[model samples]
Target: MNQHKKGLVVWIGIVLLLLAGALLAGPGDRVETVQETMRDAVLHNVNRISLLGLKEVNPGLISAFLVTIILLIAAALIRIFAVPRFRYIPGKLQLLLEQAVGLFDNMARGASPHRFRFVGAYIFAAGAFIFVGTLFELLGIQVVTVGGHPITLPAPLSDVNAAIALGTLSYLVILSGGVAANGVKGVGKTLKEFSLPISMSFRLFGALLSGLLVTELVYYYVNLSFVLPVVVGVLFTLLHAVIQTYVLTMLTSMYYGEVSEPSPPKPKKKKQASSPAEHA
Candidate 1:
């Protein structure tokens, strides 16, 4: 376990090294301070919004959304068209996915057999959303705008990232489902259910954002030597990535656990005797 974790850290370091090399340069004046970028993002993207004929067009959000949608489509297409019989992908990928699903299903069943479906549905949705977010990061799509001058919000209805949309949709589902199931009594339970996904998304975004900020700050001030920034940045970014994945998976388990719990069966009413059934 320790060795595996260590390897993951090393892998993260490599990724961060690559990302930093691409985003941050040297001690030259061309370097932009984290504060400056943040200020630009915040000022340029506060509450202000622009709309065009029922369409919203925020460049950053749109980029993220489009990339997310495209990736989802590609994944779908691959699943539908590319994935072949047992001869296609080596045993590894298929085995891993099957094992994961089995493990999750077993865990969920332990909670309640009836709830496994709901939990599985959520796990699928959340996984899709996170996968999209990861792709956005890889593609260098800036979902959050930090500094520009006066901040402005993008189109609300049209340009929302997968995470935000997933979180919002889950919240609504929980809220509505809980209400219908138990009325006001289920509100708290439903909210708790909703938080799993919302927190997962926020936790991920926050970790990545912090890593980004720290990397930028280091390049701005410390003026570190070669390879050192790479090492540190990689450390932080990988930490963020791992933490995010763990949190997401854990929440998925929790949701599945909850939904799987079985409700007690209702007792059937006893019929009244009619004078020994009229001597029947």
Candidate 2:
């Protein structure tokens, strides 16, 4: 009972200290209004980046590139140093890799048994990209804009263009699976759901953008900025990362399954017996 009371008192003291600090800290210089801050968060034009002698590129594109490079490097390193060390008994790394691969493989097989191999590989790559890209924002990697303003690179999906490209790519994969399985019928089937790419693109964009906007809002205010931003930002980012990854992969697998389903063989027509009268 005494230990519990002591712990409670410690928490109370910490809270009081935080409150005092917040009170003592004066309001920060208001360089931008809340509206302006939010607007900047939503619009990439405000803080355009430069890449390959090109100006006005979105910062999210840089984030995407960085994430891609990171993944590639990690893949190469693992292939070089990790795969050869694997044992039949399975260590932590091997077990983790197996589980991750198995998850998408199982999902794909369950959804599209006829063509799970490609679907599994595609969704695994897509899921990894989405999951890693979303969490990349948490690293708070800052890049200088073309205008010399330093801004933190946002999640790739937070940019509509990245999200749209991914959605379109996933749709194309599904369409290809359909074409491979059912030919023209598959194309027609996939075409009928043309709005899928748009919906998927916006879904990813909106979810990631919401987290970005909220984090920006929290960080904009000086008083609320102390500890709240960390909690809000991490919770929102992690939640969105896991949720969006699962949602996209699951949807892709399900749709691919639907489109790639093999057509039932046409029933054989029963031949009518030759007319007995004509035969006679």
Highest TM-score: give the candidate number: 2
User: Each model's number of backbone clashes?
Assistant: 18, 0
Instruction: Report, for every candidate in turn, its global Cα lDDT versus the true structure.
Output: 0.51, 0.90
Q: Which candidate gets the maximum lDDT versus the true structure? A: 2
Model 1: number of clashes? 18
Residues 111-176, candidate 2, lDDT per residue (tens digit)?
A: 998999999999999999999999999999989888787889999888888999999999999999
For candidate 2, which ten residues in a row score worst on lDDT? Answer: 23-32
Candidate 1 residues lying further than 4 Å off, grouped into runs, are 1-33, 40-60, 87-90, 99-112, 141-165, 173-188, 191-201, 218-225, 232-235, 252-256, 259-280
Q: Write the per-residue lDDT of candidate 1 for residues 1-280, one digit (tens) a residue.
A: 9999999999999978865875586455543456675543323333223343354334445544565577579767758764664354447766765665665466545543444565555555455445444434333433332223232222111123434564566555445444555556456666666556567545554554555445545555644645666565565445555555445645555544443334456899999778966988
lDDT of 1: 0.51
Each candidate's root-mean-square deviation in Å? 9.4, 3.0
TM-score of 1: 0.56
